[model samples]
Target: MHLNHSPNQNIILEHSSIHLAIKREDLIHPFISGNKFRKLKYNIQQAQSDNAFRLLTFGGAFSNHIAAVAYAGKEHGFKTIGVIRGEEIGFKPELNPTLLFAKSCGMQFKFVTREIYRTKTESNFMDSLKTEFGDFFLIPEGGTNDLAVKGCEEILEESDLIYDYMCCAVGTGGTISGLINASKAHQKILGFPALKGDFLQEDIRKFANQDNWELVTDYNFGGYGKIKPELVTFMNSFKDRHKIPLDPIYTGKMMFGIFDLIEKGFFPKDSKILAIHTGGLQGVSGVNDLLKRKNQPLINL
Candidate 1:
């Protein structure tokens, strides 16, 4: 994977006086882009050091992580296995865009029920997998780990210290954890979780060493993978205005929260805010399919 410095693009907002810029990590790569690219960098190196040529991980029906791991594996000459959640999707994989892409990238699938997937980290489940397949490098769901966090820390450059707030969409908390560690002492790292729960605090604390971060729990738009028509409208309008595409699952929700907070005067006057655009745009096609089926507004790509 080519490690490149993502530029921060200033966003002009007439409604708020806050200085805002978006870290264009989404432009890092077409497939292994954004935080996924960061998260996998060290993990792939560790796998090579350990002499493991196969990479195995977990994700849902439309997981950006799954798509990324597949492409990364193909590009890096490693066999990939995706332990997909939901066994039903395995029977008719063609219907799922994410799974189809992974398959095309030579990623073998081991679809399991949600109940079984819950024990993915357990010794018994892992041993069972090793017996079925050979030894492989294991990446946790959403690719969050110590090595992943180390890669993400590099996302913030020295110039980013000018920003008062560093914001990011939290999935497994890897990206935000890195941001918290890399941020200046006075900078507050705000994480907007895609999932609806307070459990992420613990997950983040496991890796984060700083106390400068807080999770804003009010803008999940119901829950992970759940989106309302208003949120869709906001994302589309944002793209039309800014010419930046945000994935529905993560960045879109975070941007919406930021805009709402701006309207509510959450940030101090003249405060500089930097929002990290963690890439998951590949999943937009799948999301658009769902919206079309529901006869709702589609997120503009």
Candidate 2:
């Protein structure tokens, strides 16, 4: 609820005379946390308003969106169906924590091949899904519709106006768009995109009216769901110092970029920075599994 400051012991902050605090959106809900909660809030309302009996969405192997939607659907009395990207995942749900959690929350899986999944936004594919699943509320992948942006706009409050900079991890561009819309005129919003490319800038501009935002494209490591050993070490040490666990997919990359920028003197002296922790901790198990296979250090969850 409160804008809790992170006690970052990174020496660069002290040298740069910059202040950093984290708005812990992750603490908003146990299951439906952070930006996921914000993104889903209005979408759920819209679905209910339409008298929809079921909610159908899309996601990949270990998508936080899938997990959040499943839990939110079960808790709010809507049947959930996930049109998963990988067909192989259907056979080994138990091995994947995100999928397992979704299944436990009573989400039915319609695992499709990558080729079919690529047509998720096509009319014919959607028509086929409607034919098979019957009438349902459609939530796009990553839950970044206009309504989701509306919900995320509430992530920043008047109390947050004291900060000079507002930063968040960008997935489908919904959360940063909301932050850009809600941010004070004096504050500059920075987005650390979890995935690669300049394409998200266009997606964000579709919802964002303000021009006070820029995406920091350096800290993605490799891309979405990709992590390096150095990142794992930083995340583990950061948790040790701050007692706040960051997921590798989003918040961790954002924080890593924030610290690196601080070291590089990107922020002006005496500037206050507020970084949002958009919770995706559920995906850590899946990431750790990959790390194990690679014989790399796992995230200390």
Worst 10 residues of 1 by lDDT: 1-10
Question: Highest lDDT among the candidates is held by which one?
Answer: 1
Compared with the true structure, what per-residue lDDT tens digits does model 2 show for residues 37-60?
A: 888998998998999989999998
- Per residue, candidate 1 scores C-alpha lDDT tens digits across 1-301 of 8866688999998966799999999998888989999999999999989999999999999999999999999998999999999999889989889999999999999999999999999999999999999899999999999999999999999899899998999999999999999988999999999998889999999999999999999999989999999999999999999999999899999999999999998999999999999989999999899899999988887
- The TM-score between candidate 1 and the true structure equals 0.98
- Using TM-score as the measure, which candidate wins? 1
lDDT for each candidate structure: 0.94, 0.90
Give the clash count for model 2: 0
Structural similarity to truth (TM-score) of each candidate:
0.98, 0.95
Clashing pairs in 2: none
